[model samples]
Target: MAVSSLSLSLVPRTFKDKLNEPRWSESPRASELPLHHAIACSCDRTTGFDEEISGNCKRRPLLLGVVGSLTASLLPASSLLAQEMPANYRAFVDLSDGYSYYYPSDWREFDFRGHDSAFKDRYLQLQNVRVRFIPTDKKDIHDMGPMDEVVSNLVKNIYATPNQIANIFDTQERTVDGRDYYTFEYELRSPNFASCSFATIAVANGRFYTLTVAANERRWRRVRNKLKVVADSFKVLDI
Candidate 1:
């Protein structure tokens, strides 16, 4: 499996540094494959985290499709990712890989070896979202097989380590722009830690894209809905 890369234009850590920075800066990571950058808003215009994410995701085209695609069944009127998103979630767009997803404005980029792009909580690293893609000959996610069986095999055999316990809670399939996508919920528990997560996968532009958003088991309930928005928002764009 040959994986591709992802990138996002991250904001500087300090308020003073933000004031002097450009609106759309390049990703700081180095990669052999081409990487894309997010279209960011001017940092000085925001007063708090809420406004930052709202402004960033709303103004960027990368997220317009995401917000537009949330069906009524997926999001009730009161859902945060409904017609109007909360001010704390921003979009991370990879123009090159042709995929995008939302994440908390407070999270910072980190190197999660094997993943093209990732972001984690400043204090709790386990609460994070990451995306990676690999070349594939298959034309659609359905090419893998039935949703339940395929998801189970991937989680139990590929995603989880031999020593970890993997339990899949649910699996779903959706179609957007004539493309098929499979999203699932699962738990991976090891001797040291346990985490619950939602994963979305799709095959497009000759690549298999996977985006996972997770949180520690203890924090799952509190952050599940927010992370669900991230997982559902994963979009594979036309490259």
Candidate 2:
């Protein structure tokens, strides 16, 4: 918790910095986990294909604050985990749209989302939420309504305020081995994207799936120690 030299001059010296860490000029894969160099662990808010995950797990700052306090238990009416994420962090190549799951890698499969999707179909391509900002809006974000209600209506409509933006915390159901799914977690601190916000989750493909980790408020208190090794390295596989 010692980064503030004005956020270390807002980080980035050579990786052409502007906040999109992890990515060492390519050429490092076997299903990923070593291209760090700076931005620790990001898959936005991952965890889905857990074969007891690997990447040698061993990052302990109180286990990254118990995985960012279990991402407010996936948003059970908001508790918000303003930072704490890193457990030797791991996850790569997990994509399934069956009932909830994601963990990009395959070099992010040409990362595409859409509002227009051209000019190399959007840049900020670090893959796995840090820079998948993707705002051309209007259709084919998977045609909306179902990635946990487009991440709970974008945090209950652009970062909460109507009674702390609640409702839809998988009362819509979410499960594993027994199947059934649909999950969501959320938190915010506005300036509407400049004041920095984080703690988001969505799990769908059955009912739903969404997770976020925006950053600010001092890197969300130094990256909330690593949001429970990125939320228990989530899983929903079938692919």
Candidate 3:
């Protein structure tokens, strides 16, 4: 549950060595904000079903395929649900999107590009938590490929790496409510600063959901376990 230091040299140097490359942008786009926030912010908006009906509905099964070459584990729903949130954490739920997670109660929410939801430490600009989703035809994560390949592609392409050093520390796949979720732990280092992030991914309702929690590398050791709580707390609710 704690974040550990990693040697940069041991990681594969798959990206071009661009020491002077500009720092990657972590801000979310303007257009992407509305879709994610609309549901969470619209407290009075009604989706028609009553409270009783909503509580009784069962979650749909996730049609996951074989997770190739990767160690896939089944997370017990009881354990996940049973885990207690720390006193300093607060729950953030998006009923319309059918997902929920916990974040540090002290952190303030922010609008970041392409992210459905985002939060930042009151003081540290680099410490953040964000969630985003993309439409997909695949029903399960395995449809994308093996865990290693999927993570490698994600780091190489989607993540910002202008002049950054990337390292993969761990990869885990868990099943909850019949859905397969992948959690990736990694570090990104630059000439000026370094950061570590934990990203949880899952496919549901014809879309891919990703929730990422990050902090400055210097602060990682102090906050690792707390961030893991945020990562593991992510749940795809039954819609």
Candidate 4:
């Protein structure tokens, strides 16, 4: 018999720093620095235990209904989907939340307030993926209403903050396992900095789920495809 090896590497912080501080405050919410951990392992097929980027080899559990208002300028954004998970990406499943998605292998876990699960770039705090969910009576994402109206309202009014300008560039729809999902692209610009993101939403298992992956506007063109992988991978599983 052969055994697989797994390891976790924690980035160090100063003694004066609180263990879980929200670094990105300009946005609506904050980030709890779980001191992002690097993990190397696979989900145990037999046990069904999903991998969390932590010191342990495996752990259980971890949503967004939208993200911070996305309006850099509503350009003609295209719907980009990945047919298959890439070699560089890893699956993140939250059995507790009844949702799962794929993230980049190098990204690590961070405690983002009000989110079910979140991962960020080791070097760039601004680049990340986050999930959030809330109980709902609605059975499908389409229940929220027309895709354009829902996305426009979400980005402009819900996700964007007081200081940011938001806009929607594109919107798309998909059905998986008979469940409908709404996916969209948007950007947010503040006086100081700007960011763009892909957001996917669905309703299932009595919950409304949202997943968003983002990168700084300056690097959006270079990393958008990779982030789209995370966005397209969002799926809801039966409880």
Candidate 5:
């Protein structure tokens, strides 16, 4: 299956011109305006403009409404993204190491030799997430090699067992917070068992970080979207 990408913008706008408008000498009484309009114009007092305009203050609500509408429209997509995030998951931030991500909250941390951090599902033995880093002399993921070659070598040399056959399904390159990341999806089938994984590779703070999320092939289809969320959440925090 093809991997999908997600994007979000969270910046809010400041209506400086409307906010800086001069106050009128003679202010209209609150009773003179409609209830909603009166409430909207009340912002002037809080904004340090003590006086109100004599003419229809309808423009205040319009200006405020424009700003409010803009904010309302921009917020839901991002908010829904957050709200719909798996409730069983929680954020993990390695401040000292300068990396952060979200993982299944119920999963327990474990020592997976050579990895900086690792987590495994409580119920599914094959479901796991791991992050490891290596000091990189190069500055970026591309410097190691082309994305395909790098991912191929990683699967064949590191993940594929001698008796197992690995098939690459999809690969994607993305940038987050100005850092580039290469993500790959693949399946490894052995004589007895099969597992699928999504791995993301990136370079930051002079180290190459690899985050892998895996599950039994039988369960992969059911949980691929959840695992993808974990895979995509891996990020190098700003130092």
Candidate 6:
């Protein structure tokens, strides 16, 4: 008897596809990232598919909900165990309380908020990306708006023009223990700015987590990538 090879191995097409799954439709809530991953992969899996081809129609992420100690268990079972996130990432733990997970290398953290900051503009520049965090609660559920309106305001105020935003790259709705939230990325750059921006919003820990990064378009491409890692990695503390 001949030994059999494992049935499925996914190989993404295109350089972008290799780095990430094709972008999904813009999400209106931050709690849908997991589902968006499934949906986008589903779309990609069908396109260009030939019945003549033989492979697993594996869509969705390798580690759909793996995090913390659970990740260790997933390593052996998950098909994506071989995949790795960005090197510069350090897990962020809290939104309003300001806690974070440290890199094993002991990368020094930066101060985004200065004296008396109210979340409009507190940032820490990393590599070519600038990141900021904002927190909101049930009393302040105003941060999230309809996708069109939010994008409209962002394009107008940030770029001094309404039409600057084009081609939404990816969107997902995510949650931590059943709260609602979402994240979406718009490809944008303006005259006054040196780079484009990838903005994100989420509701976790009874608070909304928002971050915007402005950096060279090419350099900042990983902004949302890292943000997604952070958002998806979030797990509600045992409360």
Candidate of highest lDDT: 1
What TM-score does model 3 achieve against the real structure? 0.65
| TM-score versus the correct structure, for each prediction | 0.66, 0.24, 0.65, 0.66, 0.63, 0.40
Question: Which portions of model 6 show Cα errors greater than 4 Å?
Answer: 1-88, 95-107, 113-143, 158-168, 192-194, 204-207, 220-228, 234-239
- Tens-place lDDT digits, model 5, residues 1-239: 10111111111113453343321110022112111111112112111011111222223322132144444432332232353345567655444355666787678655444454567887775698877665555677777778888888777656676788989999999997688999999998999989899999887776667788989999999999999988988878544
lDDT of 6 by residue, 76-174 (tens): 312221123234443322222322221211233322221101111124343222222223333222345655555444444442344343455555655
| Model 3 ranges off by over 4 Å | 1-83
Arranged by lDDT, best first: 1, 4, 5, 3, 6, 2
How would you encode candidate 2's per-residue C-alpha lDDT over 106-166 as one tens digit per residue? 3232222210000110233211232211212222224344565555655565445544433
Worst 10 residues of 4 by lDDT: 71-80
lDDT of 3 at 110: 66
Candidate with the larger lDDT of 2 and 6: 6
Better of 3 and 6 by lDDT: 3
Candidate 4 lDDT score relative to the true structure: 0.61
Candidate 4 segments whose C-alpha is farther than 4 A from its true place = 1-83
Which regions of candidate 2 are displaced past 4 Å?
1-152, 156-159, 163-187, 190-205, 212-216, 219-221, 224-234
lDDT of 3: 0.59
lDDT, candidate 4, 6-99, per-residue tens: 1111122232332222121111112211112122233221210112122333322211212333211101010111235466766665443467
Q: Which tens-of-lDDT digit does each residue in 4-109 have in candidate 1?
A: 1122122223434323322211121211111222333333321211111211211221211213333222222123223344457665555445676778877877
